[model samples]
Target: MLDQISRGAVGVLVVEDDAVTRKTLCLAIESAPELKLLTAFDSVKPALAWLETTRPDVLLTDLGLPDGSGIEIIHACTHRYPQTDIMVVTMSSDEANVLACIEAGASGYVLKDAGKMDIARAVLDLRAGGAPMSPTIARMVLAKVRDGKKPQAATFPTAGDTTSLTKREAAILDLIAQGDSYGEVAKLLSVSVGTVQTHIKNIYGKLAVHSRGEAVFEAHRRGLLKLGHPRSE
Candidate 1:
């Protein structure tokens, strides 16, 4: 069965082993007007079973599950429902696990200690083509790239040697890399938020990255962008 999701709400399927944590996640999704809880499961078995027929817009899953790893779910959803965005909400801070999840098609990773609002916001951000990662997770990802521990292929495209981005798109990328919100970037460029989002979408297409984090990471890796300093307008 499916949820009674609202018209414009993002349908979320939650998979957390801990009963309390699962409840908390469901509550968080329910609290957000833009989010709808499609279903909550505590194990890989039933979650995978449900996934066979239902595709959620977002999958917020714990890495460790009773029946299997959440990576399995990520792969399944990625292959079966390519449109679905996956996020890992777990206690694991291990380097291997972090990289594994990203490789397996998870777009966002947050520690379980993150608050309800942050989790909900991360879901929205993920849906909006932004990769919402915990600060520690973000650091680990960049560190992996900096250390030359690059995987043969990323879930999203990495920057090519001759990646081409228009000046405005590059400027928007730089601003976003500097932690500017969409509205902030819009104001800085004297454009509407929709325009900023359009430029960002084009940036994603050129960079072949799905989320903001991946875009910034790939750009920095290829020296296409300077993270903290936006180019002078």
Candidate 2:
């Protein structure tokens, strides 16, 4: 495991076209000794290209960019470095963009109108493994949750309704549902190949299934995976 930096020295890539906002964001990040402002850009293209090289551990970006939507940045960064967390620091309160950013794998979302302290707090939260959203933004997320519009609730079965899966077997089922290879699952579950094979065999017996494809399909039917998640991507 990566040692948790008590006061993590952050390498941040800021993406914003507005000069004032961009500078203000950079200054806020620079004010913290633990936070190092690696770079800032006015567009998505150059920022993303730099990310391929520098690979900043944290990214703060505005949704409205001259080159492309911030969602593109989220996709590019997370694809290249899954450990690097992403946050949206934008003026747009449009629910569409917010939801899109989340779908693209943004870990935190905050508004640009936040005060300097608020902005710094957000960066601290990102470095500390917390998602800090503006009050309005937080409310919006909660509203979405209460409305039951998010995929999380409907995507998986509740514990009370889960079928007879041993804890280890259930863990394997989760990996399979995530489209992981059996070998990857074995390594992740930290068991030998034969042990993994036996777990899968037990899973089949309990579920009355045979074949990998059949097992995955049944897992989907039971709502253990999202409806449209690629079963074998």
Candidate 3:
């Protein structure tokens, strides 16, 4: 464990039941100069206890644990410290499990097989306000929404729930649903990045979501997104 805490590095808390995997994740965080490994745990109990005392800037947790599910930890983190970004690293690619974690407030989802470097970069990206998901995970999430699997009632709006978005907000959401980043949306809309962010904040409020994935999923569920057609005005 490289325990040298960088002065301004992003603090990361890791939770993985597998010993080897836990070490790998810890190493990945330590390898990046921009990230600091606050601590790593093998199960949910210790991780939850640690979270009670300290809040890390980023959370990397595995879904399955011997003591309890990682979703519990995610819930606690989101509820207590909504600013802390969370990522999931697990072997399971099941859509339902993935959705459950996202609903629990995870913004990033990556399989355990992803390279250590990729995982490290993902943490940085999450800290930088990007939703970093594995390619397969991203595809699966989109496919689920496309196949009309209605999202469950949680923090986000449910099916047939009318979320009134302004024309500008709807336009921005459509562009984002088509995979545009904040910068890209700003450029296309001839606005500042801050403006795009403000609209997204309002969109999140309207959709009752805290993350980009949740907002997009809720928007799609309510038929507010026009995927391929971005605003021409």
The prediction achieving the highest lDDT against the true structure is 3
Kindly report which residue pairs in candidate 2 clash with one another. none
Model 1 / residue 141 / CA error / Å: 3.9
Candidate 1, superposed: residue stretches over 4 Å from native: 1-5, 45-53, 76-85, 103-107, 114-118, 125-131, 142-161
Residue 173 in candidate 3, Cα distance off native in Å? 2.8
Clashes of each: 0, 0, 0
| Total colliding residue pairs, candidate 1 | 0
Highest TM-score: which candidate?
3
Ranking by TM-score: 3, 1, 2
Candidate lDDT scores, in order, read: 0.79, 0.69, 0.82
Q: Model 3, range 105-215, lDDT digits (tens) per residue?
A: 898889877555477888877775677788899888778777763443343564676668888898888777655677878988999989998998899889888767777
RMSD of each: 4.7, 11.1, 3.8
lDDT of 1: 0.79
Count residue pairs with overlapping backbones in model 2.
0
Q: What TM-score should be assigned to candidate 3?
A: 0.84
Worst 10 residues of 1 by lDDT: 149-158
Q: Is candidate 2 or candidate 3 better by TM-score?
A: 3
- The segments of candidate 2 whose C-alpha lies over 4 angstroms from its true place after superposition are 1-8, 115-117, 149-233
